[model samples]
Target: MVSLIRAIRDHTDEISCCAFSQSALVTGSADKTLRVYSTADFKEFPFSPLTGHGYGVHRCCFSSCGSYLLSCSTDGSIIVWSSETGELLSAVEHPGRSPLRVCALAPDSCLLLAGACDGTVALWDFPSKTLRRCAAASEASIVACSFSPCSQVFVTGCTHGDLKLWDDHISLLLAQKDAHDLGVTCCSFAPHFKIEDSCVELRLASCGQDSLLKIWIVSQREGTAWTMMLLHILTGQTAPVLSCAFSADGELVVSGSVDKSVTVYDANLGTLLHILKQHDRYVTAVALSPAFGLMATGSMDRSVNVWKIGDGYEETEAESQQAPCQGRKLPGHSRLLLADWTEEDVQSWLCEEGLDELVMIFKTNNIDGSEVNHMSKETVAELGIESVGLRGRLLRKIEALKAEQSGSEAPDEFLCPITRELMKDPVIAADGYSYERESIESWIRGKNKTSPMTNLPLRTTLLTPNRSLKMAITRWKSSQ
Candidate 1:
C-alpha cells in the first residue's frame, strides 16, 4: 500500500505539469507561474514563483543531469532556467504562432523537440543554439512527446488520436499509428532494459481521453525501417487518463486520471497492482522517483501529494522467486550504495543528527552523499544551507567523516559542477570551473553555450583538459 506522506497546497490554480530531479520538485500551473520546492523540506524556494509566461505553463522538464530546466507555455515560448538558482537563462521563441503544448529533451540532452498548437514540431540543436528543423507532425495539435532511452528515436502524441515516431536528429517521420479512440493525452518511453541475449528492447506507454492506457513494443527492422506492435491495452480508469510514467527499471507503470485516482500496473504483463484514490479532483500530473520508490501526483484540487511506496508495496516473495534473475534486475541507480555498507547503514547515516532534512532532500531527489559532495556552492545554498561558512564547514565535516569510514575523499576541486560527481576526466570551462570533460561538453553543446555553475555566457566553446586535476583524482582513487 502506498500512503500519502504529505499534501502541498501551494498552487492557487490547477497544476498542469510536474517534474522531479535530484534536488527539487518543479511544477507548472494554470496560474501562469512555475513553483519550485525543495525535495528535502518540501518548502518553496526563496525564489519561488518564477514568472514570465503570459499564459498557463503547460509543461516542465529537467535536463538529464538535473542542472537545467525547460518549460513551455501557452504564450508560445520555451524558457530555460538554471535549476540550482531558479533564474531564467534563456527563452526560445516558438517556431509557430500557436501555444506550445508539449516538449521533450533527448537522453543525451543535445536535442530538444517542441510540439505546438499549430500541429508543428520544432527541433532545436543545443550546441549551435539554432532551430534546425520544423515540420507538421499532425493535422491537429500535439499533446505529448517523449524520447527513447537510447536517444535515437522519439514519439509524439497528437490530439487527433495519432502517435507518430520520428528519427531524433533529422526530425524525419519513421512511422505513424492511430493509437486511441479519442485524443491522446500523454506518452512515455520505458527505460532501457536488456534481454537474455543482451539485446535491448524499447517500449512506449500512452494514455488518452478514452480512459485507456496502451503499451507498444518498438523495434527497428532491416533497411532503415521501424515497427511498433501493440503489447497491451490496460483499462480501469473511470475518467480520462491524463498522464503516465514508467518506473526507472521499466518494471512498472503509473498513471493519473480525471477520476481522481492513481493506478500502478506491472509493466511487463499489464496486471493491475494498486489504485490510490487520494485526490479530490482530476489528477493532472504524476511522476516517479526511481531511486527512492516515491511517487508524486498533482491535481486540479490545487494540491500535490507525495506518497511512499516502500516494502508495503513490493510484490509477494513467491512472485519474485518465480521470476528469472535477469527479469528481477533493477536499475543501476537504485542499487548504488556505499561500499561495505548495508541498507541499515544507509538509513542510519541518513538519520544522523542534524542531517534529517538533507536526507529527505537526498531521497526525494534520488541523490546520495557522493553526488551532494560534487554539487556547486550555489546548489548547496539552494538546498537550504544558507550560510556560506556553514555550508563549507558542513561539507568539510561530511568529507572527513566519509573518509574516516570509507576511504580517501576525492578533493573537492576535483568534482564536476554539472553532474555532482568526481571528475573522471577534468576539463576547464571558459568560466574557470573544472568539470568532468563529457559533462561540461554536453552542457556547452546542449544548453546553448551557457556555464552550468555560473550561469554566465561562455566566451568560447573550446574546453581545455585539466591534466592536473585528472592526475590528482587518479592518485586519490589509486590510493583508495
Candidate 2:
C-alpha cells in the first residue's frame, strides 16, 4: 500500500517539475522560483526559493551525484545552483534564446542536454559549464530528453510525435517518426544496464499525449548508437501521461497523468499495481527516490505530495548465506529447513495450525515438511480432504510459516516483533522500531494503522533503512 506522508503547498503557482536525489528534493514552478527540501524531514532548505530566473522555470534536473541542480526557464537561460547551499554556481543562455522545455544530465556527469521550444537541442560540457554545441534537430518543439546510462548516446522527443536518437557529438543517429500519436511529453532512461555478449541492454520509459506509457528495450554494441525495440505498452491512465520514471533498481515504474491521478506499475510484469487520486488537477511531474522508499508527485494543483512506498523485494544478507540445514531456535518455533523436517514435526505443525484432524491424512501419506511445502490444491484434495475451505486454510498457514522463519538463534534485538525473525535489511518506521523491511511493508499493506511493538498509533509509514544497526548485526554474525 502507498500512503501520503506529506503534502507541500509551498509553491505559489502550478508546479512545473519535481526531482529527488538521495538526500534532497527540488521542485520548480511557474512562480519563477525553485524550492529545495531536506530528504530527512522534508524540511525546506535554508536557501530555498532559489530566485534568479526572470521567467517561469519549465524544467529542472539534479546531477548524478546530487552536487549541482540545473533549471531552464523561459528567460532563455539554464541556471546551475549548489544543491547544498542553493548558491548560484553558473548560467548558460540558450544560443537561440529559445525557451527550454526539458533538460537532462548525463549519468557520468560530463554533459548536459536541454531541449528548446524552437526545436533546438543543446549539449554542454557540464563540469566546465561550457556550451559544446546547439543544433536545430526538429521542426517541432522538443518536449522530452533523456541520456543513455553509458553517456555516449541520448534521445529527444518532439511535438511532431518524433523520437530521435543522438550521439554525444550532437549527430543524429536514428529517428522514429510518430512514435506517439499526438505528442511526446516525457521520457526517462532506467539507471541500470546489463552486458549481454557484446551489447549492453537497457530499458527506457516514455509517455505522451497518446494516453499511453511505453517501455522500450534499448541495445547498443561497443562504440555504436543504441537501437530500441518496443517492449511493453502500459495503459492504465485514461488521460495523457505527462511524466514517467523508473525506480532506481528498474524493478518498478511510476507515472502521473492528465487524469489527475498517479499510477505505479510493476515494470517487469507490465502489471498495474496502484492508482493514487489525490490531486484535484492534472499531475504534471513525478520522481522516485533511489534508496529510500519515497516518491514525490507534483500536480497543477500547486502541491507536491510526498508518499511512502511499500517495498517487498529487499533481501537480508543472512538469508543469502543461509545453510540448508542450519540449526537455530525461536521462542515458540524451530528454525529447521523445510526439506529436513520429519513427519513428526509436520504433524506438530498441523496441530499448531489448528489442523488436528488432518494429521491422520498427512500421516497416511507420510507428508513431511518438504511435501507440504510443495503441495498444491489438487494435491491437497488428493489426500482425501474434500473441503475447499480446509485446503485454502492449510495453504495460507504454510505461507505464514514461510514469512515467520527468519533465522535461527538470532539475538532478540535483531528480531522483528511481527515476524519473530532476525532482521533482514532492517528499516526504522514512524514508531522508532527497527523491523525487517518486507515484514513491515507487509504489515502496512494489510491495513494495520498501529505499531506492532507499542500498539500505539503510527504517525507515518515512512521507513528509513537502519544502516547503523544493520552494520552492527553484520559484524556480530561475522564473529559468530
Candidate 3:
C-alpha cells in the first residue's frame, strides 16, 4: 500500500553515482567524497571518505564478490577502493578529456573494462596494475555500457546514437546497430532467468534523449553465431531516460529519467506496471539490491532513495523457484528489469505533511500460488519514527494528511522551476514567462486544464520564449 523506505535527509552535494553492497552503499558525488551508509540502519558511519577527483564522479561498481569497488570521475581517472574500509587501492587515468561513463567486470574478476569520454573502451587487469587493451567504438562520447552475464560479450552506446557489441578481447566487433537517433544515455542486458522456453537467448534494452525504450533480443545459432532483433518498444517518458536496469529474475525492468520519475516494466510483455515520483529532480542512477526485493536510486537532488519491490509486483519463490534452482532465489527478481510516480494533490485537502515521500507497494502472486513482499528488514527499519509506529498509527496520520490534501492539488505551489523547490507566489520567470498559479494547483490534483500557463509539462518554462522555445511550444501545441 505504501513505500516503507524514505529520504530522511541528504548528507551530500549533488550525488552523481551510487553502488550497493550487502553491508552498505557507497555514494560518489560532485562534492568529491565517497560516503558509505550502513544498509542495516540507513545510518551514517564515521564516514570513511575518498578524495582526489577535481570533478564529479560519473560511474561506480563493486566486484561481483563485493570485495572491491570501482569509481570513474569526470577528471578522467578510475579509482579502485577496498569496499570494507573505503581505502583507495589504485587509480588509473584515461588519456581523454571527457569522463569515464560506464564499466564492466569479467566473470573471473581478474579483468575490468572502462568506457571513456573519447568513445573508447579500455581493459585493465587487476594486480598487474597495467592497461590491457583499448578499442574505439564511436566518435561521440560513450554514455552507457554493459557486459552479458553469460560470455565475454559486452555492449556499449555513445552520445552519437550508436550501440555495438564487442568480444572479450575488446578487439573484434561482434555486432553494431544505430539503436536510437538521439544520444543513448542508458543500456542494459536482460537476464536469462527464466528457462520456460530457452533457445540460447538474451535481451538488451536502451533508452535515450529520444524518449523511447527499445528492447533487443540476442539469439545464438550454429558456431558462435548471433542475431539481434528488436522485440518491443515503450514510449511514455516525457524526457530522456537516465538509467535502465533488469530485475534479478529478468522478468521486470526499471528506468529513471530527467523527468524526475522512475518506471517499472514487465520485462517480457513490456507492461508499464508502476510510475513512481519520489525525487524532486532528475533521477541520476538506479540499482537493484542483491536481495532482489529492494531497489535504490540516486538523484541530482542530492539524495539516495530506496524502494521495496515484490508481491503482486514481483514473482515469488513458489511461482519461480523450482527443481534445480528451487531453493536458490534466482540471483535477481523474476523477469524484472530495474530501469530506473504521482505528485501530491492539494485542492481537496488542507495540507500534505509528507506526500513527497510516498511510495506504492505491489503484491504479486508467484508460480507456487503464494504471495511475497520485497520490503526488507533494513527498509522496514528505515521507516520513520511516525511510520513504523504502533499499529500503523503514524501511518494513519500520514495517510490522512496525503488524502485530505491530495484531491485539492495546485501546481504553482507544487514546485519552483528555478530551484526545484516549492513555489511560493504568483511568480514570473525572469525572461517574462509567467504561469497562472491556479493551473499548477489544479493539475497537481489530477485535474485536466485546457489553458495551462505552462505549455510544456515535461520541461521547466523558459524565462524567454526565444525562437527555439517558440518552435518547441509550437510543436507541443501541435501535438496537443
Candidate 4:
C-alpha cells in the first residue's frame, strides 16, 4: 500500500478527526485547535485557532464537494467553517452533553448531523445555519451518528445498545434489539451505496465492547417507517470493537479493535478477508482513502499506519519464509483409548460440545545423541522413573526393552505417563479436554514435556486468533 506517514504538527491531546479533502487535510484535536495541513506537501497552513467551543473539539468532517467543514465540540457548539479561509461561518449550540461523539456533513446536501452524549441527534441547515430538526433516543448517551448519502435520513447508536433512525420530520425507531451487551461504541453506513429514488439499501454496521460486529440492512418503507433485519453477526475478536468504516466500494468493511488489529471483512459474505497486524496498541479509528485505495489507522500506540490493501499486500519476514510444515507431529497413543474420534463431520457435531482442550503424549526417536541423553536424565530426575516414568523391577525390564528399541539416539521411546495425545483433529478425549485441534503436539515435542498424570488443569483456548496466549492463560486461570 502507499505509505503516508507524513510528519505534520503533532497534537498533545487526542486527534478526533482527520478530514481529508483534495486540497487539504483538516484535523480537529482535543487540544482545542484545528490544523489544516496541505495535502501536497504535508505542511501546516497558518491559521488562528477557532475559539468558540469551551471544551475540546471532538469530531470534524468535510462536505463531499470539499467546500465546507463542520466541527462538533464538548463546548456544545457545532461550528461550520469555510475550507478556503479559516473563517468561522456559524456555530449552533445545543443544551445537551458536551463533546459530541460524531459530526457528519451530508454527502450531497448542505446539511449537518451531530450526535451528543444526551441521546440526541440535532440536524442543522448549513446554508441557513439554523437548527432544522432534532430527535431524542431512549435516554442513553449517543456514541455515534451518520447521515445517508442523499441526506434524507440519519442513524444513531447510543450507550444503551439502541439504534435510532431519523428523517427531517419524525423520529423512527429502527432496530433496538440489544445491539450490543455493552454500550455501542461506533456506527456507520456503507459508503458505496447511493441514496436515490426508489429504495435505498442502507447497511448499518455497529461495534462495541461486546466484541461483535453486527451488520443490519435497513430499508425505507413506503411510509414514514423503516424495517431493519439482522444481516450478519461477526464474532472473531475478544477485545472491544473500537471503530469501523466501509470501503469506498461498500464491498468491504474494515473494523478496528482493542485486540490491536484492523480486520477487513467481505461485506457481502461477512467472512474475514484479511487482518492488518502492525498496530501495537488499541486501534481507535480507521479511514479508507477514496482515491488511493489506502488505509489509515490510528491507535493508542500513538502512531498511525497507512497501508495499501489490494495488490500491495505485504507479508512479514517470518510469514514469508515459513516452512509449510515447520512444526512437529505426535504419534497416536496406544496405551490410552481413543482420546478423540470423529464419527461425523465437524459441523454435524452438536453445538453443546463447544470447544475442549486435550493433552497428549507419544513416543518418538530422538534426533541427536546429546539431546536424548539430556531428556532421559531430566525425565528420570523429575519423575523418579527407573527408565522414563516407571518404577520397580518390572518397570526396569520394560525400560530395558524400550532402551533396546532406542538406538544411540533414542530410536523408539514410549512417550511417558501416557498423556492423552494432543490430537490435531477434533475428537472426544478420555478426559473432557476438548477444543479445536491445534499444534499442541508440535509444541510438546520441542519443549520440556510435563507429566500427563499431574494435577495441572487443562487450559481453555480462546475462540479467536486475535487473542494472545497471555489472554488465553488469563482466561484459563479465571475459569479455574
Candidate 5:
C-alpha cells in the first residue's frame, strides 16, 4: 500500500509538468516560473522559482547525473539550468521559434531534444549547446519524447496518435501509426534493457487521450533493424491519461489522469495495484525519484503531491496473500482484470451486479470480461438485449470498470541488505548488493568489517553511490 507524504501547494498557476533529479524536484507552471525543491526535505531549493521563460513553461527534465536541468516553454526556447546552483547555463531555441511543447535529455547526458508545437523536432548537442539537426517529425504537435536505453535512438509521440523512432541524427527508423486513439499525452522508456541471443529488448509505457495506458516491447535486432510489439493495454483511469513513467528498473508503471487520479500497476502482469484520488483537478504531470522512494504528481489544481512507494520489489508472503480488495471483497469476476475473466466469472459478475437476468444469455454466448470490454451498442444488440435502457446501462458499467485497478513487487536492488528497508541513499559496497549508505557506513565503523550479505571480511571499507538503483526508487512514487 502507498501513502501520501505531502501536498506542495506553491505554484500559483496550473502545473504543466514536474520532473525529478536524484536529489531534487522541479516543476514548471503556466505562471511561467519554474520552482525547485530539495529531495532531502521537500523544501524549496536555494534560488528556486527560476524565472527564465518568457511564456508558459510546458516540460522539464534532468540529465542522468543530475548536473543540468532543462525546461521548454511557449517562449520557443529550451533553457538549461545548472542543477547545483540554479544558474542559467544555456538557452537553445527551437527551429522557427514555435512554442516548444516537450523536451528530453538522453541518459548519457550527451544529447538534448526539444519538440515544438509546429510539428518539428530540434536535436541539440547537450555538452556544447549546439543544434545538431532540425527535422519535421509529424503533422500534429509533438508532445512526448524519450531516448532509448542505448541512447542511439529516440521515440516521439504526437497529438496525431503516432509514435515514431528516430536515430540520434533525427532520421526516421520506424513509425507506428495510431498507437493511441485520440492523441498521445506521454511516453517513457525504461532505463535498462535485457540482452537475448541477438536482440536487446526494452519496455516502453505510453498513455493518451483515449484514457488508456499501454506497454510496448521495443527491441533491436541485427544491430540495424528495430521492431516494436504491443505488450499490454492497461485501462486504469477514467479520463484522458495525462502522464506516465516506468520505474527505474522498469518493473512498475504509474500514470496520472484528467479524472484527478493517480494509478500504479504491476508492469509485468498489468494488474491494478492501487488508485489514489486527492487532486481536485486534472493530474497533469507525474515523476518518480530514482533511488529515493519518492513520487511527485502535479495537477491543474496548482498543487504537487509527494508519496512514498515502496522500493520496487516482489511482495512478501503476507502482502501477496492479502485480499485484492480491502475491507470488502468483490463478489466474483470483478476481482480480475476485465480482460482476464472467464465465462463463469462473467456470469458471477452479472449476478453480483444485479443483472442476473442476463447470466444465461451471456453464458450462452460465451461472454466474459474481454467480451464486455468490446461491447458497443451494436454488440449489445447482437447479445439479444432488447431494452435500450438496459443496454445503455450495461455499456456505462463496462466503461466504469475500465478505470479501476484492483491492487498488486519491489526489486531487491533498492533494499538495504542490513536494515532490510528501502534505502533513501543507496550505496554499493564490495559485497555486490546495495545497502543504505548510513547502515553500511555504520558497519564499516564497527569492528567486524564484514559484508552484510556474505558474512565475509569486507574487501575494503569503501562504498560507491549506486546511481542506477537510486533512479529506480524515484520513478514510481505517485500522488493523491
Candidate 6:
C-alpha cells in the first residue's frame, strides 16, 4: 500500500534525481537547477534553487551523515553543498568536459565517486578536497555507480551494459561482467550478510534498458580474490528499468521503469509482490526509507510520489486469518495477578490515569492488557509510541508480567484492509473506515475506486488523518 504524500511542482523540467537526508530533500532537474526542501514541512528553502551548474543537473546525493550534499551536472562539474545552510562548499571540475551522470558517496563520507560520459571514474578525498584517482572504467559512457556498504569496494555500470567492480582506496579493477544486452541504467550494492564463520555474502542489483533486473552474488574466494555469480534475473517490467533500490533491511527490492510503473519484489523469495502504476510517465527514480516504512518515486511527468510500505506482509484477509500459530501459556505468577482483572477494569485504570487515548486504542483493537505480557519490548516500540518516557514506564510494567508466550496475535483492526498488516499511517477514507494512507491511496488511484474492506464504490477518494487513532496506537505500542 504505497501512496503519494505530495507532488512538488517547482522544477520547470523533469526531475532527474532526488536524495533524502535526515531533515531535508534535495532534487536535481533538467532545468539546470537544484532545490532543497525541508522534510519536516515539505517547504522549499528560502535561498533554494542552488544555481551554479552551467547545464542540467543529472544527480544529487546526501552524505551518509546527511551533513553534506553533492550534485553533478552536464556542465562537467560536481558541487558540494552544506546541507544545513544550503551553502556552496566547493566545486570539482570533471575531466574532459564530460557530463557526470552518476555519483556515489562512501559510507564513511570520506570519499566521493563520480562516473562521467567520458567513460571514466573519478575518486576524490573529502578532507583534502583533492582528486585521488581517475581511471577509465569502460569505453562506453558510465551510467550508474554505487559503493558497497562497507565502503571498501564499488561497482559501475556503463552504457554498453558492462558491470565493473573496483577497489575503493585505489583505482583497481577487481571483476567485470557483461550484465545486460542494452545500456545499464542503475546499480546498487545490497547490504552485507554474514553467511558463515569465515564467509560473507554480498549482492549487487542492476537494472538496464534491457527491461530486466539482475542480482549478482559477490563473495570472497580461496585466498585474496573475489568471485561473482549471477543469483537471479527478475523480469516483469514491460519497458526499460531505469532505477532500482534495496530496502534498508535488504529484504525487498523496488524498481522504477519507463513503462510508467514501479515494481516491488521479495528479495529473498525472488517473487513479484506489487506493480504500482501511479505515475503517468516514466518513473526515473525510487527510494525506500525502512526507518519510516516509506517509499518515494520520481517521474519524468514532473512529480514525486511518496508511498507507505508495510513490513512485507501483503496477505489477503483469508491468508492472514489462516496464518498458523504456536500456542504457549502465560507465567503462573502473571496469571494470578490478573485473575480478577477484565477489559473494563483495564479501561477504568487508563481513565483514572488520564490515559483516555490508550483506552480507545485497547477498545478498538480488542486488547485486554492480558496479551500485553506476551509482547517483547521491541515489538511494543513498533506500535508507534511517541513518548520515550511513557514507553520506558510501560516496558518495566510489562517485563514484570511477561513470560515466553508463542501464540500472540495482533488485533484484526490493527491490520490494514489492503496490506493485512498493522497500519503505520492510518487514515479515514470516504467510506468512514480507517485504512493505511498508502494502501487506500493505491487502491483508489492505482486499482479500483472502491473500498477493499467494504467493496463499495467510494463517493470520493478524499481521506482525513486519524490523529486520535494514531495517538491511541502509540499508547497501545507503549503498553505492549
Best by lDDT: 2
lDDT of each structure? 0.74, 0.81, 0.60, 0.57, 0.80, 0.73
lDDT tens per residue, model 1, 316-388: 3322322222111111112133453443333334443234445455555665545544566677777776667
Residues 243-354 of candidate 5 have per-residue lDDT tens digits of 9997776778999999989999999999989898767689999998887667788887778877768744233332332222222212342224778877766665564455
Error of 6 at 53 (Å): 0.9
Against the true structure, candidate 6 reaches a TM-score of 0.63
| Displacement of the residue 266 alpha carbon in candidate 4, Å | 2.1
CA deviation > 4 Å runs, candidate 6: 169-173, 311-480
For candidate 1, what is the lDDT? 0.74
The number of clashing residue pairs in each candidate reads 1, 0, 54, 12, 20, 0
Q: What's the distance in Å from true for residue 339, model 6?
A: 68
Error of 5 at 235 (Å): 0.5
C-alpha RMSD of each candidate structure in angstroms: 19.5, 20.5, 14.6, 20.7, 23.4, 18.7
Better of 3 and 6 by TM-score: 3
lDDT of 2 by residue, 174-245 (tens): 887888879888988898888977888878899999999999888878898768889999999999999999
Output the worst ten-in-a-row residue range by lDDT, candidate 4.
354-363
lDDT-wise, the better of 4 and 6 is 6
RMSD from true fold, candidate 6: 18.7
- Provide the lowest-lDDT 10-residue window in model 3: 341-350
lDDT of 5 at 454: 45
Per-candidate TM-score against the hidden true structure: 0.64, 0.65, 0.64, 0.60, 0.65, 0.63
lDDT of 5 at 315: 39
Number of the top TM-score candidate: 5
Can you rank all candidates by lDDT, best first? 2, 5, 1, 6, 3, 4
Model 2 segments more than 4 A misplaced: 222-225, 312-480
lDDT of 6: 0.73
